[model samples]
Target: MGPVSFKKLLLVFLTGILFMSQSITVKAEAAYLKSKDVTLMNIGTQKVEGKIHLKGDSKQKQIKVLLIKDEEKKWYELPLKEGKFDEEIWLTMGKGKYTAAIMIHEEGRKYSYGPKITVENVGEVNPFLVPVKHVESNDEKIIQLAEKLIEDKTTDREKAKAIYDWVTGNITYDYEKFGKHQEGDYDNTYGALHTLETKKGVCYDYAALTASLGRAVGLQTKVVKGQVSSELYKGYHAWNEIYLADENQWIFLDSTFGVGGKKEYFDKKQSELSHSKQEEL
Candidate 1:
């Protein structure tokens, strides 16, 4: 009960309060550092674009944004520079419904994951930049081919016809592989590069190569998958639908069935052909 005892007790109490406050602040800061804020800049029919505003300077750390898609159930990561990043971080994901989430990963470990953002098929995705697994539009060989093929072609239609001619003329149909694929003995390597290397492929490869080449030459192109009926049989087929920016119209091309540069399927309408569309990519 003495004055000195009272002073000592008061001093200890003040010190304990200060320590608790410091601990609380540290916890709050840690929580803040473990989370981030994301704002979508733009969402197009075919594109999902956004920016992540990080709380502190994460430049030195290996910060990345993770994009999870429903179709593939894959985690696609885009590295963040200077505490922020844009949609260019992700490779072109074609038109689809995607549940996208932004995550911060640092030092080989995931630090935080934001709420999932549902981005439906927006609109007008840039096909030139978006790439499927095997469809490498930016490949050196594809780029070279695109540049060379269009060197003399003047218009988009002309360029498209030229590409269609080259594919139908050069690449052969892989009936053997198609048979095997039908029997369920398939691998995941079919795309533009495969068709280019082998000079033969099924509908998937043909469509992918066409899209790749088309996109490389500054044309917006997509691979359309669905059913087509022919004299022999009715089955699944893959082809291309290219968007002519100048014409503002989407035209169809069937390079696989157009062997020998047949113009029957080129620029044809859906009602004119026995083709039913299932998906566009």
Candidate 2:
């Protein structure tokens, strides 16, 4: 082929590629959510923030959000506290296109579909800080409690220790629930505020409560699931791995086992020693 003809063909191909890219970006941005029930605040970013409002006394109703990234799909149900929810949903599947669908939970596994908002993630964020399915890290109560726990404490480590001390001291183990759980008669317990209010819950609850409190106070905290190996306890366990940013260190703690601070599980790499994580999620 002639050089001039070849150059013209190359230019056309590049122009077509650029046009396709621009089209995808436009579609993503255009899908920013707005409806009578659901109002999405931001899109074309790593995470989307939104609010859900259900008219008239819908107690315990939840807004179920489904995030679709390629073939990967995950759902998070945000509770409708007083018939409303203000939630920030993350794009956990990393940088790419995502589709978020909002549905109103009617009953057991029943949901009424709503808008499907498309997102183009153009940013990155700290995962631990973002609230997930069970961890209501951004709740006012959680934030207030975190502030209360970390009061008069300096440094991230100290703040984390204060929160740890509170959980270990205040919350008690739910032996009955644990027994039922082992027998397959009970599902996992609820999240942070519920634990705080009840003051008794199983290991999952303990980990979630710890994560919520830690995240609220600006510490990067994650809930880890595994099986215990210690002679004291030898079954499934949930614990916390917290990042102390200033210290540039990660420490593991188990508040459930550390009831009354009797167990030396706090900041001792207890998760690594006592439990082995299941194959990666």
lDDT by candidate, in order shown: 0.69, 0.75
- RMSD to truth, every model: 9.2, 10.4
lDDT by residue for model 1 over 54-121, one digit each (tens)?
22333434444455555565444343556555433233455566655555554434356653455554
In model 1, the runs with Cα more than 4 Å from the true position are 1-67, 70-129, 260-263, 270-272
* TM-score, per-candidate, Cα-based: 0.60, 0.73
The top-ranked prediction according to lDDT is 2
Cα distance off (Å), candidate 2, residue 47? 9.1
Model 2 over residues 84-188: C-alpha lDDT tens digits?
Answer: 665566655677677777776668667776656675665576778767667788889889989988889989888988988888888998889878987877545
Residue 277 lDDT in candidate 1: 90
Which 10-residue span in candidate 2 carries the lowest summed lDDT?
49-58
The TM-score obtained by model 1 is 0.60
